[model samples]
Target: MSEPGSDHDAPQAGREPIFMLPPVVTALAGIMLAIHLATTLVLDNVGLYQLTLWFGFIPMRLLAPDQLPGGFWPLLWTPFSHAFLHANWEHVIFNTLWLAIFATPVARRYGALPTLVIFLVTSAAGALAFAATTLPNVQVLIGASGGVAGLTGAAMRFIFQPVMVGTDPDTGQRVLLGRHLASLREVFTNPRSRNFSLIWIVLNAAVPLVPALIGQDIQIAWQAHLGGFVIGLLLPPLFERSWQHE
Candidate 1:
């Protein structure tokens, strides 16, 4: 039954499937796995360390430009490159799962090309955000969490609302038959969105504490997550407003 006064009460009725995994997403995730295997399993320790040093986002390198082997050029690429690197298998698995969950909808909406752009921008933004919080040389950021977090943010734009499809009155073609884009005010005002955001923020912020409690030495890059999420949230309005009527 429809929840009280929910507009999305109408059951989904259309030829277009609501959700499906795009090959792009699967291929991207597979590439990440392949890279992990190549770096960790195929390469020797020295090679892996070299790869990490070259690709990982080292705050120290940015903070101390003179110390950088190739100078500022590496800084330009490290932000996005770091997304393809993970510290361990657990890290890659965690990030890949989240990527699958959040990125699928976005890739569906924007297709592969724009989705790739989103990944790069959010990944870089996350790295930059993390770097801002820490002192130079303190940590080398690596992982797809930032990019995945961005996808999560983008999905929030329309995923929660019910989407309807129908023929356009003028064009006689299928058009957006769903709720309009949620305004910024609406996003904050809506209980579901507000609560989800709150829970997500709190959980990520609390991750660092989990290691301490569990007696593990692993570091959680919560800073990167927050940064990427923020980028994801903001990016859609600019690029995806057009898709609202699609």
Candidate 2:
């Protein structure tokens, strides 16, 4: 009953359109921003430090044998809690802006459930990477930047390897290849996407370096950023490929 090429068009038509700044992500961003502001203003310095100790991911300190509490709830909750805490106003504002920007796009593409999963997983990965590399007693690390970085990484995958419907020209039949890669030819030929991607890498990579050059003792947690970005870039292919087969 249907035309040969109709199947190809069906997927495009059936796609749930993405709305800008999905409610869940917006709410999350607002809540996180509010918490950071409240913590900075209402809470005393000692209270803030205690909050960070409980919520922040301190790598080896939390994961070490002696430090592990005799409880499961702390382990399960730390990942989410770490995201809510921040070192300072500047730290929270920077991370919150990027989280809103990158996360909105990812939430729109993957829907609320998957987007939340990605955020938690990638944030964990970022923290894990930090913990593995840094000394246990150095300093407390807090913020959503790691998770936000993961969303950016994930977005790269969705944007680059799009799901498409193509027609078999000979038979005029439509086929869906839920996973597609941009051509190598396009990498050199397409300046816009290439430049944009390059710029993102440069800016994020530079974030840590700037403070170092200024002779500041600020630890940038470059490890988390790199970890999140790698996870973002790599996970999409594996996730989508598995989905396609299923």
Judging by lDDT against the true structure, name the best candidate. Answer: 1
**TM-score, predicted candidate 1 vs. hidden true structure:** 0.82
lDDT tens digits, residue span 78-165, model 1: 9999999987899899888888998998888877877888888999988988888887546889999998998888777777766677
Candidate 1 segments whose C-alpha is farther than 4 A from its true place: 1-20, 164-167, 170-179, 208-217, 241-246
112 Cα displacement, candidate 2 (Å): 0.3
Regions of model 2 farther than 4 Å from truth: 1-19, 62-75, 160-212, 237-246
Q: How does candidate 2 fare on TM-score?
A: 0.70
lDDT of 1 at 182: 63
- Top TM-score prediction, candidate number: 1
lDDT at position 161, candidate 1: 63
The digit string of per-residue lDDT tens for model 2 on 50-129 reads 77767777665554635543333455566667887777778887887787777776665556776777777888888877
